[model samples]
Target: MRTTTIPVAAAAAILALTLAGCSGGGDDTTGGAGARTPAPPTSAPVTSAAPTPSASSTGGRASAHTEAELTGVFQRIQFRPAEFTTTDAMLDSVYPGLTVSDASCLAPFGVGWDTSDDAGTVVFGTSNDRSMTAVVASTGETAAATDLVEDARSALTRCADGSALFSMQGKPIETTVETAEPSLTGTDEAIGWRVRGTVGGNAFTLVGHTARVGGDVVALVGWDPTSNTTNVPLATQMFVDAL
Candidate 1:
């Protein structure tokens, strides 16, 4: 998909670049699901600043949720937090769905591409190139949510060593993805992964996560220019908690 780099902007902070949760613990990827870490903070979270909602979240959005409902979720995220951006900007300032260089990898990475009657999408961003894309959708008899989460984890794990993920402005990005383990509890199932590489030669890191909260599947993705400061464990914890 047109996996271009997200539009540049700024915010208080972006998503967690570390394996540690917001409590600032450790980045352990080898542990089992039961071996979770601490919880992240709840304020000034991912894509914190209010971003203009996209069409899929508005007229094209599912359920056509009321303004009040939207505001409440926004408030939760603002007070809460993650990081990453794709052009449609969540799944980097990249897309409502991600367009990848290799077509086979599309389904798992393109988190927001599914705009079924059961789903609604919204993207959040700030002034400093920070962003998070969230999608809330219902599961069906076909086990949509379960498949989605599982497939994403599988795809990320397969691509962990590095591959051509997408192209931005014709620049191919060879990304090395590492799965993340968030400490926040309360969800039937969860999946997360972070991407590291350069876009047009500018280093960047992005993280995305999804969980099954009852019948609804919620997903969040974050992106930021890679920096020594971006790997803060506390922010990563804070970012995962909001999910």
Candidate 2:
């Protein structure tokens, strides 16, 4: 077992804000067990853009995915339309250290969807215990998306050693990251990892899955304060098919 420290204030802020899911809705259609169909590339050519550290906007080059297209990707994963919401501020807070430069071929944008309850922010579908947040981006160069996935894999591996620590407000929050080989197949590349830790005496487990399809990369993070298990593989496959 390894331990890492992470700042819980900023990270926990996003995790603590528990929003309810919409009610009276049925489950969305799920993909079949057969081979997955890869998502197509952006219609427009990707242009070069400089990375800017702005919480309110995606400073990198714009993705071909419109707000609707991005939302559609999540919807294919069984999330209702109403549950999907923009999360620029949350992304800025959690991944401040992740660089998003044109040179790096990584341009990240994210959305948050509520799986449980329905009275909080944006309501979508029914209330349950599972909630998911995803960051999808475009990589201009060939194999760039694969490189991004590997980078995340490496970072998670380091954190699993129990040596990573982040400061939350002024308190020391201990952290740990665990990863496993995914059983799902058919994607160009994919990886899954689990993070468990305590912030201000509150325990949380975050499950994440990252996969590359064509020139795009999708990173899904699911969290539940009470459980460490998540259906990330199913969600990841759905995302791939939706692409």
Candidate 3:
């Protein structure tokens, strides 16, 4: 795990594609074996759309070039300067998650505590009201990206259906994890999941994906109470393209 100072200019990006505001209409729970999404803000304006991420042939894997080199990528998703935070300890302040009910889920998707270390760099932010997070850390045991990918895959299996992940915020957000197809492409490996549960007593749906692009393991997440999961694949693609 290594750390790099984020350039001041990189924080001013304004092309937030995926999570500007929560999507509209209904939830789309029509996939399998993907990943998980972030919890929504307790209070947000319903003016922006939620988003996802994708990858490409070259210069896309943040690990191949530098450690935790995802500042620019998050910036592309409209994570304004004030919206960004590099301190891993303050994750709960930005992302809609805390400790999860199923401890196994923490290693991979939910909190990703085992994914990276404090020595590594963590860049998290909220786009408009949509929260997105990226961790550029090693597997800790050997700094191997494949190991982390396997961790996520194993988590999907161990924390099977009915597994509850509590993002204890605003009256406890209890999310149930279900497998989904990989919405992101051109990666060494990818995993996806669709989480449906309650936030503030209202039905909420989250579409999320985790992919190993080259030497980097990137996770994309977004949730809406309305269940509008349209173009989720494209949402992640937008992030992958940014890389």
- The Cα RMSD of model 3 versus the native structure comes to 11.4
| All candidates: CA RMSD (Å) | 13.6, 15.9, 11.4
Q: What is the C-alpha lDDT of each candidate?
A: 0.42, 0.42, 0.45
lDDT by residue for model 3 (1-243), tens: 011222222321222223444311112122221223434433232222222233232442433423234555544445422232332332454333455566656444435532344223444444444344344332222235566666777876776444255555436665577775564435556667676776667776666666555545555555543322543344444444444
Model 2, global lDDT: 0.42
Q: How accurate is candidate 3 locally (lDDT)?
A: 0.45
The parts of candidate 3 lying over 4 Å away from their true place are 1-63, 67-69, 80-91, 94-98, 101-103, 107-110, 113-121, 134-143, 163-175, 199-201, 225-228
Which digits, one per residue and each the tens of the lDDT, describe model 1 over residues 1-243? 112222213222333223213332223222322243455543334443332222121121122334244435544444221233331333333332234655435333445434444333333322112233455444432254556666667777665555466766566667887665544344556665667786667787766656654334555555544432232222323323333
lDDT of 2 by residue, 58-129 (tens): 233322334466554444333434433334333333333322212121111223322212111222221122
Model 2 regions more than 4 Å off: 1-68, 76-88, 91-130, 161-164, 225-228
True-structure RMSD for candidate 2: 15.9
Residue 37 accuracy (lDDT) in model 1 = 41
Instruction: Output the better candidate (2/3) by lDDT.
Output: 3
Residue 35, candidate 3: C-alpha displacement in angstroms: 27
